[model samples]
Target chain A: MEWLLEANTAGHKFALMAIAILLFAVVMGGILFAVDRPKRVPTWVVVAGFLGPTLLLLVVGLVYPALSTIRGSFYDKTGDEFIGLDNYARIFTDDGFQRVLLNTALWVVLVPLVTTALGLVYAYLVDRTRFESLAKALVFLPMAISMVGAGVIWRFVYEFRPDQPGVNQIGLLNQLLVLVGIEPQQFLLTAPANTLYLIVVMIWIQAGFAMTVLSAAIKAIPDDVVEAARLDGVGGFQMFRYVTVPSIRPALVVVLTTIAIVTLKVFDVVRTMTGGNFGTSVVANEFYTQAFRQFNFGLGAALAVLLFVLVVPIIAYNVRQLRLSEEIR
Target chain B: MTTTTPVMAPVPGEADTRGRVHSRAERAQKRLTSRTASVAAIVIAVLWTVPTFGLLLTSFRPELDIRRSGWWSMFTDPQFTVDNYNQVLYGGGTDFATLFVNSLVITLPSVVIPITLALLAAYAFAWIPFKGRSVLFVAVFALQIVPLQVTLIPLLSLYVDSGLAGSFWTVWLSHSMFALPLAIFLLHNFMREIPPSLVEAARMDGAGHVKIFFQVLLPLLTPAIAAFGVFQFLWVWNDLLVSLTFASSPDTVPLTVRLADMVGSRGSDWYLLAAGAFVAMVVPLIVFVALQRFFVRGLLAGSVKG
Candidate 1:
């Protein structure tokens, strides 16, 4: 058991993985077998067989921990003493945390709107182009890689070196500046601007997702509606404005709110690129920093609750939009 | 086929007789061939790809050259080497090869477990005439909004108390737990799409719930399964927060954690970071390209439906 738990070698890790999968299979197989017997089993037994493990895991993992974290938010650093809203007050009052809140606001607002807009334009442009699939795939490729990988790629692009006579700029952005006879700037060091630079990486990663979803929605626009608009001398921008936009409004809402939810919880891009430094720390990254690095669990729990609170309104709006779209359909 | 020439011409009324013949085709062609839109698309595609392409090019360049000059300079100097990749994979202090294997081990089970559990649960929610099924399904669906951050600290303490802290088991279990709500929600949507008469016919054949699920629904649900499977695979493999929290040890830490550490500790080593980033990206890129259709389908189903 100890060996399994502390497995380092390839052989042991594979062995452990195999054991875990096998164990899951056996337990699930047993439950299903019991439910599939010759005698008729009650619907409750069948339902329990299907849902029992999931409910157990969810209750143990998500429900309990969520409630505990909410409780922890009201406690002190050690979580032994109750402090009662002091942590939340500090988040709203402290200058450093205020910057964190401002940065998060910038991220949630800018990332979704820019990503969705770029995706919409790109999707419309390439809707029925000769190389539509290939073009869309090129943009969407970033969605496959981890945000950390995307961060590394963009970090290299934004890499900075001293503006010296002997030194040549390696970062593509810096090199471009040098080519145009401009001084190479520190893309990730400068405050406020650095946050936008980091936000670009997210926009890059999420634009593909937005494009894919919006492209499908564009395709689903009824053919007759487009034809009728075209027959009315509606072409170019006007057709897109009058015909296409209204047709995919539901999809537009989904794309916007989905990206917003994801942007609100973004940690990897900020963590990897800036380590939440230079006023680039969003709520998600700050939560990890406080809990893990700073070991201020109470503050971290407050931030986590804050994130949950922030997400609820976006989710509520999303659900409302979804309900509206379903009714229309 | 006969209207292909008219479709190519920009002049609209010259081919009025042929226009009505393949107007849909002509309209599609005109919509796509707008000169401004084409240029815009080409520009956006290049902007989207060039950053990653630059890094990919750097990963194959010699270490000194990569640090001293831009990857675009390689066109003139034209030096290339695999030493960066070799060092990142097996060199001292940074053995990403091991982390690669750890990612695989962690990802497979994390994906498999949630998907298997979600499938059964979705089946029950869709088929089993249980009391309060709709209420329970809606509850699970709503659980998707619970940010994993809210649950991380308590869950971490729980793992420590259970003596499972810093193990792969903890990472796997945490990922599975975080994934369940979305997985069950998406899969339930897909399950409900299958016709009820299919299940009824199976039941009429004296097949029990398990048998019906396996013999009837399982086969029909393959596309849905693949869609969600691709999603879960990508999510688990690409995850950083859960793995960082649970698997802090050397043995259990996956590639993202290791790469993030390398970036922190060795911020200047472009060679290792470039090679390491690509190494982490390779599997997902392949999966994304190979199974892109299903992945897109899954994305549409999960988001647009809800």
Candidate 2:
């Protein structure tokens, strides 16, 4: 039993994993077995058997914790004193947190807008081109890898060394700079531009998602609509601007809002690339830093609540757009 | 690739009109922007591809050469070795091998547990006639908007109080809980697409709900299951935050956490970092490439569902 809880060794971990699975199977199986005898069990009994565990887990895991964190936000740093709204006041007043909020704004605004635009253009370019899948796959490959993996890849590309007679630049970006007679710069260490550099990594990873969705939306455009637009002398970019963009407006909103939500919660990139240093800390990363590293419980809970607050409007807009599109359909 | 609206093939006589319209538009596109479009596409592809290629090439280079010159030097210099991979995998004190195993242990159950639970819940939401079914379904769907950040601190405290803080169980349970809403929503959408008549026919034959779920629906839900499975697999495997919060210890750390740690401590060691990054990347990359169809389907279904 103790080893099941504390799986320190490789063998113990695997054994413990087996037990966990087995335990889950038995519990689920027991419920099903008891309820499968139809005509004996009530409908609520079967419903409970099917949905009870999930509802219980959700209430315990998501709802309870979220409400508790919101409550914790009004407390003092130690989480023992009930200091009302002080944590929220400090978050709004502090200079470091102001930069965190501003940086988050930049990320939420930039990554989605640029990534969606790039994806739209790319999807349009290769819509019916030769080697379409292969071309799309090249950009889409980054979406497959971890953000940490992406951070490492881009870190090497941005790697800098002193530009002296004996030193050769290893990072490709710096090497390019040196070839044009510019000195090497530490891309990650600089403050404002560093945030942009980190955002580029996100755009690189997410362009595939936007491209994929938008490409499908482009293809789903009724051929007659395109033909009608063409008959109206809407050739070249006009066809795209009028026919393509309007047709995929719902998809465009979905991609933008989805990417915005993802970017808002982007902890991995900032954590991996800069570890939220040099003015790169966003709300998610700062939440982790305050809670885990500094052990500032109430402040961390406030940052976490701040993140939840920011996500509400975006999700509301998304749902409204979804409803509108569904109504039109 | 699955277009929701079917494309109607042009009738034989109308093909000429449609074809001419397309060709004229295409020719206009060609004459106006062929060169620029080609250049832009090529530039985007090159920019997207070269960084990963450079890192992959660097991973195969010797340590001294990697430190001395750019990976582009390989075209002129042409030196390569697997020693970096060797050192990263089996290197004393790095122990990426154990981290890799931890990733597998963490990911497999995280994928399986949530999926099974979501399948059952989705079935009930889609098929079972119950009081408050629509309200319950809508509640689960709405829960998808609860960002995992809000839940982490208290969830951590809850796990610590339960004495499961640093264990695999904590990671598994947290991931399972976090994944349920989206999983239930997606799987429910898929399940509802199945004709209710199938379940009705089974019910007419005196089959129970359990029998109908197992015999009629589970087979049909394979693609949906696979779709969410691939999504969850890549998610759990590539995850850093959840594992970093729950299982940061060496005994339970996955590849991403360990790799992120290496970047912080060994930021300058390109050889080890490059190879270690690939070690973290290889599984999800393979899964993505192989299951890309399901992944694309899942992504499209998850987002654009009008």
Q: What are the RMSDs of all candidates, in order?
A: 3.8, 2.5
Candidate 2 regions with alpha-carbon error over 4 angstroms? B1-29
Tens digit of per-residue lDDT, candidate 2, span B1-306 = 332323334354343455554556666565668568878888999999999999999999999999899999999999989999889998986778888889989998999999999999999999999999999998899898888989998999999998888889999999999999999999988998999899999999999999999999999999899999999999999999999999997789999998999999999999999999999999999998888888888888899882
The candidate maximizing lDDT is 2
lDDT of 1 at B266: 88
Minimum summed lDDT over a 10-residue window in model 1 chain B is located at: B1-10
Q: Under CAPRI classification, how is model 2 graded?
A: medium
Where is model 2 chain A poorest over a 10-residue stretch in terms of lDDT? A229-238
Residue A148 C-alpha lDDT in model 1: 92
Q: Going through the candidates in order, what is chain B's TM-score? A: 0.90, 0.92
Model 1, runs deviating above 4 Å: B1-33
TM-score of 1: 0.96
Judge candidate 1 at residue B111 and give its lDDT.
90
lDDT of 1 by residue, B61-161 (tens): 99999878889988898898999999999997989889999999999999999999999999999888878999998888888999999999999899899
Give DockQ for candidates 1 onward, in order.
0.53, 0.62
Candidate 1 lDDT over residue span A225-274, tens digit each: 87777666667888888888888999899999999999999999999998
